[model samples]
Target chain A: MTRRVVITGMGVVAPNGVGLSAFETAVRAGESGVRFIQELADRNFACQLGAVPPLEASHLQVLTTLERKTLEASGIIYGLLAAVEAWSNAGLDVPGNEEDPDWESGCIFGSGIAGAEVMRDATYLIDEGRVKRLGSGAVSQVMASGISAYLGGRFGLGNRVSSNASACATGTESLLLAAEHIRSGAATRMICGACDSGGPYAWGGFDAMRVTNRRSNEAPEAASRPLSATAAGFVPGCGAGALVCEELESAIQRGATIHAEVLGGAINSGGQRKGGSMTAANKEGIVRCIRHAVENAGIHPREIDAISGHLTATLFDPIEIEQWSVALERSGSQFPYVNSLKSMVGHCLSASGAIEIIAAILQIKGEWLHGSLNCENLHPKIAECIDPERVPQTFRKHAVRTLAKSSFGFGDVNTCAILRRYDPE
Target chain B: MAPSRPDIIDRLHRIVEPYVEDEEALTSVDEDTNLLEDLSIDSMNLVDIILDVEEEFGIEIDDEAAEQMTTVGSAVDIIASRLAAAD
Candidate 1:
């Protein structure tokens, strides 16, 4: 029999908040971390607004100066901080310098363009004929798997240490993959997360593509209005979110506090076929993934009381809402309460799914839903599909059972993770 | 003129200080103080130390010279020699 998996710990370094408590408090209050980035303005970008984690000096206290010195990549630092928080929150002991690695644990942290800052710095050094002076940690900081490597070394993880990449779907994809690893009985636990480097260089291409919001730079918080009629585009954001997924048996043995059950998740690609393109997901592929996740989870789609959509406040929001209705075979008042964390944190790219998953878990555990901020003028198309009241306008007490959190990234990659409130029975 | 031997040792000590986690191992550091074995500085960090030394003194220590810098004394020797040669 496949081992059951559950999320035992969660951590987040989000644009609006850092750490679990801060994020929970911010989400509960409907606080938006979206803000105007002066650097984007100074850089002469069309999109002058962005969201980045407001990390303080004390946030780096978890790492020594030496450790801090090596983390040149912001994404790596974000991933490491979130992973550290998740690991500690799981109540697992970190292996000491001389201690043996925990063979049963591993990490699958991912990033999208995380090495931009490091590579930019390295390019300058190389141009100056200081190639050898690039230092040792430079490559690690610039490598795609750097985030997972740092996490593995810090925790002394002996099992597989890998990084997944699937654009905006990366975080949820990683979560699904890590959960599968535990269920396959190959590992007992895994740290699954993703991060992104949100800055001029990393976001410049999207700006060139005109996919980021350009109209609401002045009122930054009003920029990312998912499921709204006035959504110009997504407000680029970055940070990390992490969850510690453990086998139920191991968790029970350790008396760990189970947060949510991983009822299993599904990931698929549209193959850029039919209406799918390099930047958009095929509706059929999304529906299939959702149906498969629900079927594999041994639950009917109607039981999914809420949806944490991959709504990035773009043209895709309506399509995603409509697809959920088609796949779940439910609509109108029967539709689940739907919300977008991106409505507050903006589109965190690879980090969005993981961060939003944490938000969903918090909402599930507390039996309340955080408002999808800045969507006051709900898009008529979305309203046509689901009841307007289903998308809450503010923090409200609403109990939800199984929640379906879906993320569709560029290149037609899609993932739907089914998470349920852990029942003591 | 070549940099003073004592000055080179001091600068070398400071450069390696950040990489060394074993504070006590750093205190008794001498010419024979092994970088990897005693100070717990790995090979990857040794390259960083070498780079910092090069940046600090503005001299390029080639790969061969960098490889010989396994101990505090050898590292200082390489730096002193490079500085003298440049002068």
Candidate 2:
């Protein structure tokens, strides 16, 4: 028998807020985290604005001396911090004198570019013939699997510790993979999340692609205007998000505080076929992915109470809205409430799916849908697909039974997960 | 000028300060104080400490010698010998 999966704990190191409570509060208040970065301006980038987690010196207190001295990777730092918060929030004890690791607990933390900052530093050191000064931990810090490796060692988890990379779909895909692991009894619990580096090294490529909003350098907060007619492009963002997915029975036995049930999900790629390209999704592929996720979740399309879309404040926002409308076979007043965390925190790249998942779960747990920020002038096309009322402009207290969250990535990959309010039988 | 044994040990203490969890334990650390047990410095961290020592004293200690540095005294001895060899 397939075991049911549930979220027992969640943690986020977001641009808007460092912890879960702060993140929820910021999102609920429609607070924007995007800011004009002076470093980007100094580098003469087209997009001088980005969202970065405001990590204070206090945030580094948890790191051991070795970790603090040698760790230069921001993504790993963020990922590890978020993982620790999630682990503690789950009420799991840190292995002190145990000879063996927790075989039942695993980690699947994902990253797009794990250690760009470290790599840049290493490259400079190598060029200067200071290669020997690179330090022993430098390689680990730059490795793509660094986040998972560090987390696995820190938590003493012996099961399936791995990292997945699928651009923006990574975080959502990690959760789906964790749920599958739990359902198949390979592991009783899994720590799933993703992180992305901020600043020029990571965002330079996006800026060069001219895909980031460059017009809002002066008014940083208003830059990420998803679903708006004046929406320019996605604001680059960085940070990490994590969730602990445990077997429902194990969680209940441990007396863990259950948050939401992971009602199945679907992951698919457009294969860059038909109208799909390296960056854009094929319309049919997205619709199929969403429908399959809802079907696999054992829920009808109309039962979806809300949608946390992959609306990255790009021109594709309306197209995403239309796809959701077609996939669920509901539109206008019948359409569910839809929102995008990117409107506040910007697109966090690999970390977006995981951070947004936390936002979605919060909405379900609180029974309130936080409005998408800066979308007051809703795109005409999107307005035609869904009622303006469905696109709330402010936080609204409403009952959200089942919420569908979708993530689309650069490789034309798609992942959708359905989360339901846990009702113990 | 080559540093004295006590000077090297004092510098080693400063280098290992960040990795040492118990700040008080560092004060009483002697030749017998195990780097791993007493200072909570792991093998990976031992490597960093050794590298920093080499950079600070302008001497190179091979990996085998580094592995043998299990205690504060051993680290001091290794650095002293490496410095003498350089001289």
Candidate 3:
């Protein structure tokens, strides 16, 4: 029999705040963490800046030593810090600090651009006519797998380390892999999630894609408007999110508080760019992933009470969600309360899936779903996507039996995870 | 380090043959065979192939080279250039 998997602990280094308490408070208040970037002078992009976590020098100081130089936009370091907090929360002995060689734990993390900031800075130096400015450790510093490896070594996890680079879907994919590890008896416990810190490369890339909100330069906080009819495009954001997944029996034996049950997850590739566009989100592929996850979870669509949507404030996302809704309708399932976190946090790319799962878990725990922060007008098509009046309202009375979150990324990678609410009653 | 074109092709086939499903379809594939069309390798798998080649050759293919590796011939040429540069 496959052991049931549950999230024991969660840690977030998001724009709203760090740690569980701060995140809970922000989510409950429906706070917007989107902010403007004053450093970039070019007005070519509508949004000058994005909502980024306020980094303390002390935070990076811990990850760096005299012997090892740290990478810029040290997202891996941030992820490690969050992992430590999650470990502490789970009441597990720090891995490397313990002498036990047989500790059964692994790490699977996701990142869109692991050390993009490092590359950006190095490239800038090379562009500035300084041939010697390139650091020799550039590859190691920017490797996407470095974060997972660092976590594994730091926590004394023996050998089992995986890193995913599915752009926005990376976090959710990590969770899926972690759940697989537990089900397949590969690891008894796992740290599964994702993180990313956008540097100039990300900014430039998104800018070139012309998918970023450029008009919200004046209203940085109100820029990311998911489901809103006026939304121009998405805003670039950065953050880290992680969770500790343990076998249900192991968790129960440890007397750990079960947050939610990882029911199932599915991943699929959308064949060749549709409509002659690479960035065009594939509706069929998106629906297949959701359906597969729902089927794997052994739950009908009617059972899902809420959906933490991957609705970045882009033109195509709402349409994708609409297609998803049409599929749900065809499946004879109820349309759950659907909303997007990108409206509040901007799009964290690699950290997106993990963060969305975190939000779903919190909604299950607190029995409240945060509302769209700046959605003055719901997209007419998605206006019926969910109840528009439900915006900015909290739902405590409804028993959330199941929740689903979907994440999509470049290369048409689609991943969806379904979670079952943990009821104390 | 200077692997012949045939050697490079053989090695690439070894790396990608497992991933390629239509064995009969790919059996007649030549140097000009487009990886995307002939082998039907997806972009994500293409990334895996590049990483595999990097580890095997101990040479990094820059983004430009990686992007240009659309066909067997291009991949071989890119590998050759990187190997020569490294030497």
Candidate 4:
């Protein structure tokens, strides 16, 4: 028997806001987190604008001095803080002192490029013959699995503790992986999330590729213009998002608050074939992923009330809209309400999927659809595919029963998750 | 002015305070305090404490000596000897 999975708690350290309440309010108001970063400009980056979570030192007061001393990796710090919030939000004990780990709990946290800053520092120290000065924690911080390993140790989770990387789809893919673990009865609960570090080091390559927005560097607030006619390129962003997925029965047994039910999802790769390339997705593959997700969720496309899109404010925004329209066979007035978190938080890279999923769940629970920022002048092609009324320019209160959220990465990989309002039968 | 032996031990206590896992050990840390047993400083954190000492005292501690710094007194001895040699 397949076990049912539901989101019991969620936490977000987004560029727009550090916590769920703040983030939800910012998104509802269409607030932009993109800003002019002086460090990027000093480094001679083409696009000097980026979005970064405003993390203060007090946010990490729970860490020990040793942990703080060794904490050079920004991604790990963000991931851990977000995980703690989610754990507590689920009404779980913080700093649990159980003699043995809860063998049923696990984590599948991901980071696209972990510890680049620490690696760079280590390289410099080693080059200068100060190898002893390269602290022992350097290796742990630089490893791709650092975030998951740290979380596993922190929470005493004994189940499969692992990290996954698939560029931008990492966060969404992680949630789907956790759902499979529960569905197959491998684990009862799992903490899944993804994080990315901000700065010139993490975003230098994209800046060099000229894939970041350079047109609105002076007007940082309006830089990330997703699904708009003035859209240029994506603005690099960093932060973390976490969700606690628990078995439906397990959550109810523990009297946990159910945020939303994980109906089902699908993941696929285009193999970079046909029109797909290293940086672009195949339209057919996208459509297939969406259809498979809806089918797996045992819901018809017409049942989807809203869409949380991976619209990165690039030229591909219209293409993404078209793919969704074709996959659902809905266009013009028939199209579902669609919004992009990237419009406010910029492109959070690996963290985008989970962060956007948090926003989607919040909207579903609150019975409202947040507006898509900077899309007032919608792209002509996107307008041709969906009616302007379907894309709200401001927040609207409407009951949404089911929501579909998707994330597509640079390597032609796609993941779509179907979420439904929990109506216990 | 060069720090005396007692001064070095006191300073080491402050430096080691951060990495100590046991609160009681932190309160009564002295020359005989076993870094591993009393403070519960793992090998990874030991390396960081050693690095901190090196930076604080402006001395070079090779890997061989760093491995032998298992107790608070042992660390103080190494730092004092290195300081004397420099003088």
Q: In order, what lDDT does every prediction score? A: 0.91, 0.91, 0.76, 0.90
TM-score of each: 0.97, 0.95, 0.77, 0.98
Across residues A1-425, which tens digit of lDDT does each residue of candidate 2 receive? Answer: 66899999898999999988889899899888899899999999999999999899898887877688778889999998898889988999867644789999999999998688888988999999988778788878888898999999999998999999999999999999999999999999999999988889989999999999989898998999999999999999999999999999999999999999999999998888888899998988999999999989989998999999999988889999999999999999999999999999999999999999999999999999998889899999998888998988899999998999999999899999999999898
The digit string of per-residue lDDT tens for model 4 on A142-181 reads: 8989999998988889899999899999999999999989
lDDT of 1 at A28: 93
Q: For model 4, how does the per-residue alpha-carbon lDDT over B1-87 read when each residue is reduced to its tens digit? A: 679989999888888788776778788877888899878877667777877898889888888888878888898899998998888
Instruction: Score residue A299 of candidate 2 by CA lDDT.
Output: 90
Which parts of model 3 are misplaced by more than 4 Å? Answer: A42-44, A57-71, A96-103, A124-137, A273-277, A330-334, A384-386, A390-398, A423-425, B1-87
Could you tell me the lDDT of residue B60 within candidate 3? 83
Pairs clashing in candidate 2? none
Which candidate's TM-score is highest? 4
Q: Which sections of candidate 2 miss by over 4 Å?
A: B1-3, B20-28, B32-40, B58-71, B78-87
Q: What's model 4's interface RMSD, roughly to a tenth of an angstrom?
A: 1.3
Give the runs in model 4 whose Cα sits over 4 Å from its true position. A94-98
A392-417: candidate 3 lDDT, tens digit per residue: 44434345668888888887888889
Docking class of 4: high
Q: Report the Cα RMSD per candidate.
A: 1.4, 2.1, 15.0, 1.2
For residue A210, model 3's alpha carbon misses the true position, in angstroms, by: 1.2
lDDT score, residue A111, model 1?
Answer: 91
**Residue B58 lDDT, candidate 3, scale 0-100:** 84
Question: What's the best-to-worst order under DockQ?
Answer: 4, 1, 2, 3
